[model samples]
Target: MTAKAKYQEVLDLGASLNIQNGDVKEENGTLKVWGTANTPYEKNLIWDKIKAIGGESPSDIMADIKVADNSVYHRHTVKSGETLGKIAIQYYGKASKYQDIFKANSDILKNPDVIHPDQELIIPNA
Candidate 1:
């Protein structure tokens, strides 16, 4: 497969993430991709996708993904029936780290257990 076709899923992921200034080009046998992500989490997601498809350090692709926000790991919108533990697990891979998430969102969250849908919570860099 052509380099571009081989990484089509990565391009699609970038589009779905609403990457800014996205550009894609295939030169020789390498795919070059550039874009700006809203947060480190999003940027990592792109790299993870690329690595998943191309291996850990594939020479077939070169991506210069930038992060627009470095203050927080991610800004997550709460969904119904989602708890801090769940969000923590999704981001930190440990449910017990919910306290950190609660503390980071203390301004908006009066209680750790109380969160409503649509509330934007900061997933602090942990």
Candidate 2:
């Protein structure tokens, strides 16, 4: 397959993420991609998709994904029936890390267990 075709999913994912300053080029069988992700978490998701498609060190594709925000790992919008512990597991793989999330969002979160839907919380880096 052509390099561009091989990495079509990566391009699609970048579009879905609304990556800024995105550029793509295919030269001499190498697919080159560049973009800025809003957060480290978003950048990681792009990298994970690339790796999943190209293997650990696939030489056919090259990507330069930059993170726009370094202050926090990600800004998470709370969903119904979701707890900080569950969100922590999704990002840090540990439920106990919920305390860290709670603390980071302490200005808005008066109680760790009293979170409601539609609240935006800062998910501190692990």
Candidate 3:
């Protein structure tokens, strides 16, 4: 599979897990999850298993908040000859929005200018 396709596959697997419930309450322009699962140990175990398989946490798992849906969030892998700007334009329709792509994927991208093959990146909608 292509690096981009592989990255998306990993994201699809992560979205399959019962991780986050999209019940965020908006207050003063801030969206917050209303409730949390009581059994943290059970939740942690689930999270650990997901992590062991190269999946990333959707949000702060420890926080008393529901999980958010990230299915529409595109995951891109850096291939040779790919640039952050190119990715931004390809996904968001604007090269200047590369910063948005970079910010959404800070976990995987240490430097915007430098990305390697197989490194997954989140592509946020504009």
Please provide, for model 1 over 65-125, each residue's C-alpha lDDT reduced to its tens digit, 9 standing for 90 to 100. 9999999999999999999999999999999999999999899999998999999999999
Which parts of model 1 have CA positions greater than 4 angstroms off?
Answer: none
lDDT of 3 by residue, 9-118 (tens): 33343345444452434344332333333234323444454345445753322224333433434556689889999988776668999999888888877888988878
After superposition, the stretches of candidate 2 with alpha carbons farther than 4 Å from their true spots are: none
Compare the candidates by TM-score and give the number of the best one.
Answer: 1
Positional deviation of 28 in candidate 3, in angstroms? 50
User: What are the TM-scores, per candidate, against the unseen true structure?
Assistant: 0.98, 0.96, 0.43
Query: Candidate 2 at residue 67, lDDT?
Result: 90
The top-ranked prediction according to lDDT is: 1
- If both were scored by TM-score, which would come out higher, candidate 2 or candidate 3? 2
Worst 10 residues of 3 by lDDT: 58-67
Q: Ranking under lDDT, best-scoring first? A: 1, 2, 3
Q: In candidate 2, which residue pairs clash?
A: none
lDDT: worst 10-residue window of model 1: 43-52
The TM-score measured for candidate 1 stands at 0.98
